[model samples]
Target: MPVITLSSDIGLNDYLVGAIKGQLLTAMPDCAIADISHQLTAFDYQQAAYICGNAFGYFPGDTFHIIIVNFFDQHPKRMLLAEYNSQYIICPDNGILTMITQSKPVDIKAIPIPATAKSLLDATKLIADCIKQMITGKKPDTTEVKDIEEKYPMRSAVGTDWIDSQIIFIDNFENVVLNVTKSEFEEIRAGRSFRIVLMRNSEFITRISDNYAAVQPGENLAFFNAGGYLEIAINKGNVAGLFGLQRYANASNMQNRLLYQTVRILFES
Candidate 1:
């Protein structure tokens, strides 16, 4: 059965996702519809890219990914039918395509969705139209590729080095994800010890936790997330919302304008 995977920042509140699946089923009955995520931060392209780029490959070949982040904004209604590593993606021409394409040889085709459709609902119908045609063994009518945009995989943009002790992303747990990779942090350690400070007001946690359980229950501590980024988190608190920490592509409140301020990663090396 053909599969459709959905990724979006749209929370599970409205009937938007349900309506999309209903439309898809209307065209292709018995279609396997899965969810990459519906909890991505709104307009956070970095998080979307990370979630999609990392997980899309895990599914079977030719799975269609519908990404709705920043789609209906003031930007042009440029949909894309992108094929990378045997997977099909339908999304806006926003830099997301550039990031997900990731140097891989992809067939980028423009889609004139808004022209044929009147409103966003119509646009959704158009998207269903494209997917249905593709699933029915027909080549979807897609526009030619235009100019390419630069999509940086990391938050700080491309061509820039990750600074030591730099904060990266904030997770749902309010855990601050630092840009410093395990290898980078290890190099800086060089057998020397280091301490982690939270907001410079709380007690300084001197020990680096190898796992989440390193800290006492309900006690906030620092550690590396599965992606190997350093994370600052309360054992059980809305650290992000509580501390005003922004997650994934959100700018932190720092004077550098280059660095975010929610949780700064300072080192003793």
Candidate 2:
């Protein structure tokens, strides 16, 4: 039995997740079902894309990943059956699938799920049926499948300000993580003087310490996170709640929090 993993913005509060799993089991008895993550920040494609990209690699080969986020939201798109890195992903063609596999080569196919299957419940049933057919050694008919644009429109991984870094996602702990990697930041800060500034009250945090301990307790500091992305955090405070930094919700505020614009690094010789 092949492993089928499900991910989406659908919270656990409702029966949506259970309903999808029940449908999968009904179609393919004894099949393995796994939950990659159901709390995907509801309809935030980038968060879903990042979670799927980072977490799916840990699963075994032949895992069928089903992403059901933003299924009925604005901007209608097609279902996709893409094969990459020995795993198969079933998701919408709204570029989330493309972003996940941007660094690698993939075999893309547009799946034509019945339009009448408008609701998430109906779509899940149809998609599950299609996967069951594949597991039963039957190749699905793709004659009517609509092919997406040859290339996906994922924005370049590089930040809009190559010279400066962009604030991407902050964690529950209020750690400010930047889209720019440490290496890139180092290259940009070569011999140039800069400083990390907080946009909340225009407070200037000048010290770039090696770790949290490098700064006094309750002070703010910036360092490379485990993922190699530059991160900012208060020595012992919640940066987000304290600074009021919310992502995706407040678009204009995000631009104001840019490390270079809102926060800057001074590289002094």
Candidate 3:
């Protein structure tokens, strides 16, 4: 049986999630459907990319992923069918694809949608059809699509002594995940001591911890998460809520950029 993963912003409070699943099953019965997440924040493409990028790799090869987060970011003229790492992804023309892939996928094509079709279900139908073709070890019927929108994941702004990063995600426990990866951190450290500054110079985590247990309760600690990103947490406490650090979001406005607190890692010789 073919495996299809669904990641969408549509919450499970209503029938829409089931309806979309029904449409998929209607398109191809006997296909196994897996849910990656349903409570994704709409228009929060950064977090969406972080979540999907980390989660998609664990699944078996040939898994078809249907991403519905911010499906309406643009007019529904067409959607994108991307084949990367032997996995197939069907998402909107929005930049989430590039953000997740962190690069422009070489094998990408455009799946045209009917102009009259203007609903998530409408897009689901087309995606379901594409999966049917892909499971047969063939390309979906799509047109050559170059020049699709691109949005890369944010990275730390590096300096000789400091690296300024953003909070890409906060978990249910309120541990804040930064955009900095282990390789980036190590590259900047160069075997020097470092401090993870949260709000001000007065409050900081001076070293990387193995996990939350490495610190006393309510004490702050920093560690590289399983996804290889820097994460800040307080043992048995809420880091983001207590520190007033919000997820990174910039409307391209100066004021909008100030809404979230950035994670700055300072290195010392």
Candidate 4:
């Protein structure tokens, strides 16, 4: 049976998610439907990208991943159908695709939206139709998907003695995930000791723990998460809530924003 995965900002509290699933099943009754998340922050592509990017690789190669967060970002006349790493993704023309993959897709096409379609449900049905066609070995008439016109998530700012990063995601347990990866940290460290400074140097973590059990129940720790990104957490506690760390949109003056906080790693040479 074909597998279809859904990630969306449409919370489960409403009928929209069920409606979409019903539409999908109506088209292909035997297909398996899985959900990545339905509580993604509205219009926050970075968060959606982070979650989908890390989760998509674990599914089978032919999985069809549908992302509906901020589906109207550009009021696009067409939706995007992207084939990357042998998986298929259908989402809006927004930059989330590039943000998630960190590169341009090799095979992408545009699925036209009818001019009369205004409601989100209309678009949802269109997506279902597209999936049905793909499952039957039929290709829709489409144009090449274009490059994103806007900026995506920022890379870590590297300096001689420090790597400046930001909190990309904070999970339900309140553990903080940074934009820096383990390989990036090691490449920059070159065997030098480092300190992870939190909240603009108010506090710091000096060791990379293996897991939550590596530290006492209330102690703070740093480690690479299953996604291979560096994370900060307090064993059996809410690190993000306690430290007041939150994810913010990428802006030119992001540092000056009221809730903005940058996670810095200072390497001792």
Candidate 5:
């Protein structure tokens, strides 16, 4: 049986998630299936990319990853099947595949969506059928899919003396993940001292902690997380609630303009 993973914005609140799984299982009995995350925010491509990008590498080679978030942002014409890093990515042709993987794939095929396929469940059924064909060494279409849409992940706006990074993610613990990775931080620092200025520069963290214990309980700290992005947190504290930071959200709303804030790093020569 083939291994399949699912990532989506459908969440688990309803029967849709279960229905998707049922389709995949009915297509291939005894097939191993896993869930990356089903509670992802809809239309938040950057956040979804951050999550799916980090997750896909952990699965074994040839595993098919089906991402269903923002699957219908446009008229449904065809689906995408991309071969990348020895794995398979099945997603809608909504320009988000590049955002997740951050690369252009040379091998991609278009899996046509039948006119009868009107709902999300119908799409999953199509994907399930395609997977069946693939394992038997077949493709829905042999012609390479060209002229597909593409989008890149949002990167921090860098300055020579400072770096401004958005709060791309906020974990269950309320710890914040910035867009700036460890290597990006080091490249900008250049052996200079720096301060992580937050909340309109009202608060500052002068050093990166080795761990939560590096600071006293309820105190703040900065560090590179396992994913290599800069993280801001407090020992046994709710960093987002306390500091008023939030996951990337509505840019037009005044509150979200403040909530969808960035963590600033100012380098001192």
Candidate 6:
């Protein structure tokens, strides 16, 4: 049986999720459906990319991942179907796919829709049809598959003594995940001592904890999470809430404001 995983901003509070699942099952009753998440922040592609990128690789090859966040960006008349690393991803062409994979897909196609078919329900039906066709080994017309426009993830700002990173994700446990990866941190440190300073509170962490419990309860610590990204958390408390840290998209500002909290790591010379 085929495996279908869903990640979306469509929360469970409404019937949309159930309705979509029903449509999928009705078309392919034997296929297994899995929920990656349904509570993604609306139109937040970075958050969706981080969550999906970390989780998708663990699933069995050939799994179909349906990402439905920011589906209506600019009222798109087409959706993208991409195959990467033996897995399939279906989502809007609003750059989320490129953000998730951090590269262009091996195979990509644009599924067109009639201008009259503009509702979310219509879009869901179209997605279901695409899923069915792909599973049956029927290749979509070559003309349908087109070059996908790409979008890049935010890069950390690096200096001789400092690496300025942004909080890319905040998990349910309220742990703050930064864009700085373990390898990047180690490469820059080169065995020198460093200080991780939080721009929000002016507080700093000097040690990298092996686990959350490495520190006494209620104390703050930093560690590279399972995804290998640096994370800040309290042993038994909410780091984001306590530190007043949140995730926001990079955007223009009239005053050139910083949208999210920044974590700066300064390596000792």
Candidate with the greatest TM-score versus the true structure: 3
How well is each residue in 199-227 modelled by candidate 5, as lDDT tens digits?
Answer: 66578898998889999998889999878
lDDT of each: 0.68, 0.68, 0.86, 0.85, 0.86, 0.84
Backbone clashes, each candidate: 3, 9, 0, 0, 0, 0
The alpha-carbon RMSD values of the candidates against the true structure, listed in the order shown, are 4.0, 4.3, 1.7, 1.9, 1.8, 2.0
Residue 46 CA displacement from its true place in model 3, Å: 1.1
Cα lDDT tens digits, model 3, 105-161, are: 998898889887878778778888878877767777789888988988877889999
| Model 3 whole-model lDDT (C-alpha atoms) | 0.86
TM-score per candidate, in order?
0.77, 0.76, 0.95, 0.93, 0.94, 0.93
Model 6 pairs whose backbones collide:
none
Q: Which prediction has more favorable TM-score, 2 or 6? A: 6
Q: List the residue pairs that clash in candidate 2.
A: 193-266, 193-267, 194-265, 194-266, 194-267, 195-264, 195-265, 195-266, 259-263
Q: Write out the backbone clash pairs for model 4.
A: none
Give the poorly placed runs of model 5, Cα more than 4 Å off: 141-143, 250-260
Alpha-carbon lDDT of model 1: 0.68
Better of 3 and 5 by TM-score: 3
Tell me the lDDT of candidate 4. 0.85
User: Which order, best to worst by TM-score?
Assistant: 3, 5, 4, 6, 1, 2
- Looking at model 5, report the run of 10 residues with the lowest lDDT sum: 250-259
Q: How would you encode candidate 1's per-residue C-alpha lDDT over 1-269 as one tens digit per residue?
A: 89889888777998888888889889889789999888876666766776787678788998888888776665456687778888888877667877766663457887776555555556677788888888888888777785645465553221121133434455555667665566766665565656555545564566678776777777767776666666777776666565565543455544553323533434443
lDDT of 2 by residue, 205-238 (tens): 6555688988887887888866566778888887
Measured on C-alpha atoms, candidate 5 has an lDDT of: 0.86
